[model samples]
Target: MYIDPSKKPYPFCPGCSHSMVLDAIGRALEKIKADPRRTVLVSDIGCVGLSDKYFNVHTFHGLHGRSFTYSCGIKLANPDLLVFNLVGDGGCGIGGNHLINAARRNIGIKVLCFNNLNFGMTGGQHSVTTPFGGKTATTPSGSPEKPFDLAGLVSAAGGSFVARVKALDKEALDETIAKAFQHEGFAFVDIWEICTAYYMPANDYKKQQMDELIASYGFKTGILREEKGREYSRVLNSAVRFQTSDVRRQTSTTLTATKFSHTLQKDSIGIIVAGSAGMKVIFAAHTFGKAALSCGLHVSQKDDYPVTVQSGHSVSDIKISREKINYLGIDKPDAVLIISQDGLKEVTDILPKLDNGAVVVYDKNLQIPKTEAKLIPIDLHGLDKTVHATAMLAKYLTLNKFMPIEALRSAITAISKDKIRELNLKAFEFGTND
Candidate 1:
């Protein structure tokens, strides 16, 4: 029997799912009587790196999004010992092509994908798992794209065993982990955890939201069973040949709107510059895009990666012109919404190059450059003093008379009706009026 390390407790932030996954894996090991010295736990960058320091078992921390490749190598060399991988949604989803190819090869390793809906380790940025309309530091407006369902992806990618279980569901989760270990081939388990600080709402709002999600979706653990045979061996061999090409094709599909010229001409479009507020802008843009499409408007988007996390110049540009727009125009914003101090500093560049046509909206505290465009300054900081929710702040901006208030409200309601109504009604009212 292997001794549990006294320092086994990993240094993950409160509300993270890594601890539960580690415990479940450890319990699974105990159930199977696996020796710690022989077991190798491999993880990629981010919170999984902490596993190297915390777990008493032999551990390996690989490059960002390369945990599975390393696990493949380790298991291929030492086929007798057990190999496990602990990875986050960002690590898995970002490197999804490689992971799925690894699965198809029937690599003898167990994978615990900590699918906390978004990237927790990177300060709650929007990830491939971040559901549509979910808020994060990168997407203050809300995430625009829908999250990737790991179970379905892995299952279709030829994983011998695949499951999706909630982190809060201890019994079901524990059972899923045990079963994954028992499966004689590659196994994948996705653990859904909450990011309370970065991605989720505040304390009171989160509790209510959690209750609602539990009541609605409940907890689920999916399992796919595949017997080992000649067919399986044939499949594995063929997978290795297509792995590289398949991955390249999948990577080609990721959202790639880089230049301003590509983003601006939509009947109603929302552009999100990548970084701290990228999540928010994407959510808002997607919402507006849907509303516009429903109203028979062609929506296009422009997006670019930000230079850094805080204190850098960033912009989320949306073009809502009725006319057709094929070229990107940063200076022609219809009505701008500024969330961060960085946004305010870079407002001049965001203005549409048009003369006396665009509207500039920002917090009164920001120093709007003296320009030819009409400026609408709202006291958001003062409004925030009364309403603490970021969702509320977003809604307040959505209700401005200059923009499509009703459509934006409809988008917010469609995504998070209860939270929008309960948390931001008062703030929205005050900001709209004040």
Candidate 2:
């Protein structure tokens, strides 16, 4: 069975219309004979999201309103797999842009939107799809906004298939969903439902009045639009074939060979280089990582900085090891390089946690926090601030004899161009001489 029987007693409010929709989905999948291993059920946050556990197929529970985006990625990555997204009216409103774009792209993904006329999961607030004059927790006097006709919107947005069906209509719900599953391109089904816990009590709703309410809102039931078109993935693959081959050829021509002449004393080492923005901190760390790679070592580098692009502290955490590195985070770094006041402030807490044998390299003008690690003060004030990171890293490597100076020079040559290359090489020479 597509739905796991072991997960019996699905979580839903008594008399909730969502339960009916879930059952319809399972029945439709069975009718299509879809393979559970190749089928993916992507769900957004809300009362409907709780249905993921009941499905035995591959499932992804993601952030609210993002189920369509995730489903699109999965479908594009492997067009052979069947991808389905379960979203609520609240999700439809929040992710309205994604909804229209998904339809416009004509990607092969089926969307089943549970429309209960309100934000049922979050205290029954008025949602983008809430009917005009509908009573909700946030709209006690009735909502002023006109509800969205999801089927019509998707149809206009270029969806290959679109339909609207009542959740309680057993035969129609099952038939509509099955047809959507069989469609080759983007398909959407708007399932009209009721929120028993919030929307029902507020509106004094009855199951018998569902048809009348749909008519009063000017919504039509059954298939609204259907057409044949080329799927998005196939079109993209055909368009990019030549460009992809050109990129591969251009990449292969730039590669160079080098020999290793240095050995690391430890199995692994974690290093942090901290500096201000525009100091090329990340670039220096990447160059250092390449030098380590030339010495036949594995390397990983992660960079951090404030959202304000050019006016904050910047740091690079680098891992170099003889063995393959899995995790990138470093709790206690073996070496820390601080080159600016901003960099000093960023690493204050980290300095106190360093072990006794660890090294803390910083500019001579800066006051450092107390730490058990050995401190090495350097005269970096005379050099260009942008080159301070490379200079400090060079000094550390030269002192430990962990890597040959020639390897760093080659890396700087390979990574930098024009006047910047000359400056970086001079900085490396200064660090070694000092």
**Top candidate (TM-score):** 2
| Tens digit of per-residue lDDT, candidate 1, span 225-258 | 5545222333454676599678666534422221
Q: TM-score for model 1?
A: 0.50
User: Can you give the lDDT of residue 409 in candidate 2?
Assistant: 83
lDDT of 2 by residue, 1-434 (tens): 98888896778889889999999999999999999999999999899899899998999999888999999999887888999999999998899999999999999899999999888888899998877787998999998888888888888999999999989889999999999999999999999898998888888876767788888877788988888999996677667877888766754443213356667888889999999999999989988888877777778999999999699899999998888999998877999999989899899999989988899989999999899999999998678888999999999888777778888888888864778888788889888888
- C-alpha local distance difference test of each model: 0.62, 0.89
List runs of model 2 lying over 4 Å from the truth. Answer: 1-20, 44-55, 61-66, 69-73, 90-101, 104-106, 116-130, 133-145, 156-158, 168-171, 193-218, 228-258
Candidate 2, TM-score vs. the true structure?
0.80
Runs off by more than 4 Å, candidate 1: 1-5, 202-220, 224-434
The local distance difference test score of model 1 is 0.62
- Please state every model's RMSD to the true fold in angstroms: 22.5, 4.2
